[model samples]
Structures are given as structure tokens and as C-alpha cells.
Target: MLSTSHTVRRATSALLALSTSLLALALSAPASAEVIVRGTEGAPLHEARPAPGAIFPDEHIVVAQPSPSEVDPSFLGPVLLMKSAHIDLEKGTMTVPLRKGRLESGELVWSVLTDVTDENLANLHGINYSAKLAYGLIGKATRSARIEKDGTFVFASGKVDFKPEHAVTPGDAPNFFPPKSAQPGAIGDADYSPLVQFENGKNAVFNMPMVAFDASEETLNAMCDGAVDKTVVHDKVTAICPRDGTVTLQMTLGYTFGKPIFYLSTEANDPVVATLEGAILTPALNDTPFALEDAAPGESAERIYVFVNGPTGIDHPFRQGVNSALSDGGHGPLNVLGGIPTINLDYSPIWRLFPVLWTEEAIEKGWRTKLTNAIDIENAGAKGIVVSIAGGPPQAVGFLVNCPVVYRIN
Candidate 1:
């Protein structure tokens, strides 16, 4: 069973404002914590681990588990605990148990795992770690919800309309920067965010992905054998089995500091957000109201990395092939999602898109190389080596996404 409504979005802005604090708190994961490191600095990671599949022998990192005294178990992601949940790194799939909860108004909200308090929590939950989320503490970056004793999630704000027809049209080759046009499959309201903060006296936020809303358990259980209803669930969902209580999501291959990773692209604040991420365009996000074009500072927003001159060709080892020079008719450059496992200490589903273009002089003088981390990008920029579109500084294009890191490809 599936349900969606554009009207629900029209009335969500004001309602979302009432719960900003809770949502903000939900996305906040303190940065002062140790991280899990594997393998030597430039060597392959050890093969013995809990996660499934053998990835390329490279660096692999996850967050350390948080202390029990600092967080409530209820606030942590529960997918890893389910016997049925499994992650197949070779096939690039994460199948987790679904959670059945309801809204205060009795609307059903079927959610799944992937969100955690921090990397430690991520490690415990067997999900990906995103350092970017630790800084998503301000603005309307997340939604507020309270889990009642009766399994009801009393939401303060944020609703989605899965009814809108989703579409992504790639531009002609050589200029795929701005897609022809795009429409997010599921449109979220002003306060719609995947980061769920339980206001039930828990000081933690979980990056929970709500797979279905106002859906019946019996109908959802049909997915165990039947086809998944894309109209009812998130677009990234590939398979869902309510009977077994597991949902599988399709992962996009990407790079972070030269390491391969797999992530889920679900909701975005703008059409450009959807275009760059190959995600859905959500118009209602305009109401969330955050600083655009690089004004977001401190706990305001996280970064979405774009390579100015990465290796080109789909078969390239680095696989980022997003250089403007290679104007092939490719649909995506597969830009990097900043602040993953061993990278930085910030992660958020909501991201601000900024294009990094290498200066002609830098390219001419053979100063170009695979730039890793913001410092590398910034240093090159300072030396007049790189600039975004129009020979100017790369600016945030008023876009954001609710993408959660799921798996790493070593």
C-alpha cells in the first residue's frame, strides 16, 4: 500500500519550525571521539572483519563505539542487531530490517537502518561512517520526532510526497554540469530530514531512513516476494521485505580521498542538488532556509566534494572522470561525498554543492593532480590554480541532500 500527497507538503513549513531544535539535536554527533583505523597509512586493510565481502586491499575506517553511559540504546540504529540484516560488499547491497512506527496522527512510518550517533555507533550498527554529520547541528537540516511507548513516532515537522513523478534528464555530452531537468521522486517538506531525533529524553540523533509512510504492515510484507512499490518508498530502495522485515537499497559508487565507497542517494533540497547527485528534485526544501553560496559556517552545513580535474573515462582507476576537459556524454562525474570513515569528522545527508574547476593556467603548466581533501583544493585555489565555473571561486549552489554513507569499497 502506498500514499502520497502534495497538500501534506504545503502545510509542513510552519509545523516544521516548531521542531527545529529537536531535529538539529538529532543530527549533532559530538566530534570528540576516537575513530577505528585499519591497515597501514598507505597499505591494504586486513581481511578479517565482521562486514561481509572482500573489498580491494586498501584503507578501511569506521567509528569507534560510543560509551553506553553517553547514549541510550533506543536512540541508536537497530538494523545490525537483526539476524536477517546483511551487507554484501561485493554486490553493493545493504539489506536491513524495517521498523514499523506511526505518527501522532496515526500515520504509519516504516523506517530502516544506516543512521547512528557516530562512527562508533556506525560500527556497532554495521553501517558507513560520515564525519560530515557531526557538524549538521544548525538550520533545518533534520526533522524532529518522538517515539512513544506504543511505537508511535510523534513528528514535530517534515513530511514527504512520494506522488510526484521523479525524473532526471542528463544534458548533452561535454556539458553535463546542469542537467537538462530533474524532479525528485519523493518530495520532502520544509523540515523533512532523515536524521531523526527522539525527544523522549535521549540526547542523540540517528540517521534513520524512513522507507515508507502511511503504509500498512501487511501490504508492505508483500514486498518479501512481490515487487517494491517505488511510489510508496524512497527512490533509492531496490528491494523491501516487510515479512522478513528487511529492505535493500541500491548504492552509488563514489570516491572519497581516493578510496572507493558506496552510498545511497535519496532526498535533496533542490533540483541542482538532485542533478549533481543524480537524486530527486524536492521543491519543498526551499523552506528549510540555510545559508547558500558558501555562507554556511560552523554548524551550519557540510560539504559535497566536486573534482575539478579528476581522471576521466568510465574505466579509469580513480573513476572520478569529471574533468570538464573530457566532455564525453556521461551522465555523472560521481563526485565525492565529503567526510567519510577515515577522512574528516563531519557528515550530513544534507550537503551544499560546490563545483571545483581547474584554472587553464594550472592545466597548461602541468600543475594538476588528483586533489584530496579541502586543503588540497583550497591550496590550489589560493595559488590561482583552480576555480569553479566562470573563472571565479566555487560557490554553493543552494542545494542539499539527505544521503547517508552505507559501505566502503576498501
Candidate 2:
């Protein structure tokens, strides 16, 4: 559930801080002199991708034998493991059980359960369907698996390390999408937009990390070639997939902003304004509604759609990031270039008189804002966001207030 309350956010922040500190201390401790789970090791994975329909290869299946057991505490993502996997070659595509068709791209896309339950003791926790998985590159991240049935259980044992290179081509199947029938560039209705929303209040901050964008041309660079510009960087290994392309980009973001708030725009050239304008959202579209339309020479219209990172301005106990960009021209830390209309309290005087002034107030509040939008986004479902820029006189006013810069949830 989404929360935008002051107290709720503050408590969460405290918990996060404490957890981070503890993790730091633990990592600094010596390695555990213990044998965790023992089981057959997985193959070495270099690069692989999921077939359009032949995905989610590994399921929590039942086994006649108990897997291994973990001796140390580790995170397990999704319990689902692909019975099949796919690999790439210079020729065409290498078919794997988990893979259905061609694999020409230089990337892999596994619906990796980012983190899993820490059931290291003698006890076992049933599969959690609510756990979220991400499709991306490999990491040291570990997950545990086991066989489950109505009457029996077998622990798959050991922590499963993610490795795209471990994917091997498997036998062919009748259901595999033949190269002749595949839609190369037609991504029909794939969701590529990754968004970040914030919930703020008097003493709370809810930060959602920004995933790779599946929308624009730059998104493609992020997926396949891996590009980093002044705006956003994929320094962290985030699974990037284009809405249209055949291969998925298993990569880490090279850059990041000061906060969770980022810019969003239809245009790619427009400068990004570091202001907490509104929540990043992606309205549903059967086909990408806003394509890259061209502009005439010397025309200042349609420059670029930039999203500066900041907070999601949800209304309820005074959110800071939801302030008017005109209020301070985004002289604040948490801001987005592709800004959105957050605060409905668009009082005429405040906007017309002192746009910069509002920005200062937003800054002094310490990067807090929340937008209340009721889209059909599921808890962990992929979503998008949009922001609108202010025009006319506000541009001349410069900035309102310079507030403390907030950190993004890296």
C-alpha cells in the first residue's frame, strides 16, 4: 500500500537508518566460518534473455529430495527458478529450455527475485507470491529455493547466485516463436517507463528508486549500449529493457541525482529543472501516445523532456516537493526538469507574485512532497510519470529558496 503521511514516513526513515547501520557493521565483521546450504552448483552464466512467452522458467516445484540448507543468513528473491535458460552466440540464437526463441542481443533478462526470505534456520517459509522480481544483470545477490508439494517438501538447499552467463541453450519446442513469426520491433503493449513516486509529510520521507526508462530513444542506449549523460546515470546494475527492442539490457545505471525525484518530459532537449514539481507518472497507452514529433528551425517549442530527481508531492500533512516550480524556480535541491503539476494549491497570487518565494519555502521544508494520483499501478508493477514545465514570467524570477539536498534511495 502507498502511504503519504508525516508520521508513517518518519518511522520508516528511522527504521531504514537503523537497518543500514546494522548492515554496515555486519559487513565489516569477519566472514562466517560455516558451511551454509550444500547443493549442486548452478552453471556459469554470461549472457541470456527470456523468450517472449517462455519466461519464468523456475517455479517452486516439488522434489522427492530435500535441497540443501543455508548456514548463514542471506536474501532470496523470488522462489521461481527457470527450468530453462538461454544463451547467445555470434550466429543466430541458442535455444534453452527456459528460452523459447532467438537470442541475438548482448544482454540477459531474468525476472530475478531481487531479494528473498532469510529462512536459514531449520524452519521453512512458504513461497511468497508478493515478493517482487526484477529483470536484469547478475549480482552477488543470493536466493534460496526448495521443492514443495501437497504432502512432501525437499529443500533445493544452497543460495542460488544470479548469473546470466550460466544460461545454456536448451532443446527446441513447438511453442517457440519462429523467427518468421516474431515481431522484431513491435513491442505491442510492453511497459518501458520506470517511475519514482515520493510520499512526504512533516517528518517523513518515502523514496522509491528510479528504474530504467522504456520510453525514449535514450532508453535504448541505456538498455543495449549503456550510455551515461549529465542528467541520469545507471551506475547501479539495473535491468533495462526497451519497450520495443528484442533483447533486454542487463546493466547498472551509471548516474544518479541527489534524491528520488527525477524529471520526465516528451522532449529530450529541454533543460532539467531541479524542482519538486509533481509525481512521476505514466498514463496508460495502447501505443506510445506521445512519439517524438519534430520541431521547426528556430522554434523553442518541444526541446527535451527532462525529469529532475526530487520527492513525490502527495497532499496530506504538508509535502515539500509538491511546491510550485514558479514558487522558487526550483532553486531547491530535489527537483526534476520534466516537472509535473503537484500542488493543486496553485493560488494565483503566490504563483503570479513570487514564484521564487514558493521555492524557498519548499527548500526550507527539507525536500518533502507527495502527489496523490490514483492510477492502476499494482504494488510492484512497472509504471511511468510525466511533468509539465512553467512558462512566461516565472523564468525571470530566478530561484526561491535553496534547501538541503536529499539523497536518493540508491
Task: Give the number of the best model, judged by TM-score.
Answer: 1
Over 38-98, each residue of candidate 2 has an lDDT whose tens digit, in order, gives 1222234512122111111111111111111112112111111111112221111111111
Taking all chains together, the TM-score of candidate 2 against the true structure is 0.18
Q: Per-residue error at 324 for model 2, in Å?
A: 5.1
Worst 10 residues of 1 by lDDT: 74-83
Q: List candidate 2 stretches off by more than 4 Å.
A: 1-280, 283-321, 331-410
lDDT of 1 by residue, 22-126 (tens): 788866743222212222232244322332232332213422233221243222211122222455554455676677776666777777656655556666665
| Candidate 1 lDDT | 0.56
* Candidate 1: residue 325 Cα off by (Å): 14
TM-score of each: 0.67, 0.18
lDDT of each: 0.56, 0.21
Error of 2 at 165 (Å): 37
Which candidate achieves the best lDDT against the true structure?
Answer: 1
